[model samples]
Target: MAYWLFKTEPDAFSIDDLQQAPQQSTFWEGIRNYQARNFLRDDVQVGDQVFIYHSSCKIPAVVGIATVTKGAETDPHQFDLSSDYYDAKSSKDNPRWVGVTLCYQQHMPRPVTLKAIKADDAITELALKKAGRLSIMPVTDAEWTHICQLGGTE
Candidate 1:
């Protein structure tokens, strides 16, 4: 199975929120970026692993693990006029946005802080390290294992 990293604002939706959801699963949506949308739609799939990272916070970190319980599908919100993620140019027959469903796997013993990630050379090739912003991004098996071990969840 492939690995991925999904970022969100902790205050908006923390790992605890996902853990407490019904069936401990939630649809990953509201992605407006085209590149991220493409990954969510075409690359991500059911049974793949995920690192639920808390971004836009005091100390950004990977706080938990999740599993993609559902594969890519049209994001219903893109069709709802009232939704902040609505795309007026998008149609039901030709959706411009897509997402997947993630189920809570387990929380890390302690968050693997961005600082910690940066401090390690082994994971420097990670997209999170080389790229500035990406809501959803791929992760190599080595990177995933290293991070999980560092976070005490391996």
Candidate 2:
């Protein structure tokens, strides 16, 4: 199965939030970036594994694992005038955003901090290391395994 890294700001929606959600799952939404949206709409799929990374935190890290329990679907918020993520230009006939449902798998045995990841030359190709700002991105098998190992989850 494909692997991915999904970044979220802890204060806004932490791993704990997902764990506490009904069925330990939530619909991933509010993605406004086209590139990230494309990944969700095209590349990501049901059964895909994900590394839930905590960004914009004191110690940004991959704190947990998730599984894509549902494939991509139109993001309903994009059509809601009251929603902050609404796109006025978008219409029901031609939507501009999409999201997927992810189920909480497990917390990492230990967090794999960005600092620790950046220090490993073997994982230098990671988007986080390459200065990527996208909230959602793909991850290679090797990178996933290495990071999981470092996090004591392998």
Candidate 3:
């Protein structure tokens, strides 16, 4: 299965929040960027592995693991006028956004910080280093393996 990295603000939705959700699953919604929406809509698949990265915090890092429990569904928030993520451009007939449901797997004892990742020789070529701010991004198999090892999952 394809591997992915998904970033969320810890204050908005932390690893603990996912772990505590009913069935440990939640819709990965509110992605306003078209490219990020496209990844959720067209590239992600059920059973795909995900690196739960916490961004915009003191130490931006990958803190946990999750799996795609569902894929390629219209984001409900897009239709809710009261929601901050609501999109007037989106419609039932032609959605402009999409999201996936991710099921929590496990949290790392210590988060694998961006500094740590950058220092790792195995992940020098990771897109995260050069790209820097894509909310949803692909993770190479080798990078995934190295990260899991860093998180003490391997």
Best candidate per lDDT, number?
2
Regions of candidate 3 where Cα sits further than 4 Å from its true position? none
lDDT of each: 0.92, 0.94, 0.90
For model 3, how does the per-residue alpha-carbon lDDT over 37-103 read when each residue is reduced to its tens digit? 8888888999999999999999999999999999888888999999999999889998888889999
Q: Write the per-residue lDDT of candidate 1 for residues 55-127, one digit (tens) a residue.
A: 9999999999999999988899999989988899999888899989999999999899998988899996688
TM-score of 2: 0.97
Ranked by TM-score from best down, the candidates are 2, 1, 3
Better model by lDDT: candidate 1 vs candidate 2 = 2
Candidate 1 has a TM-score of 0.97
Over 4 Å off, model 2: none
Indicate the residue-level lDDT of 49 in model 3.
97
Q: What ranges in model 1 sit over 4 Å off?
A: none
lDDT of 2: 0.94
Weakest 10 consecutive residues, lDDT, candidate 1? 123-132
Per-candidate TM-scores read 0.97, 0.97, 0.95
Candidate 2 vs candidate 3: the lDDT winner is: 2
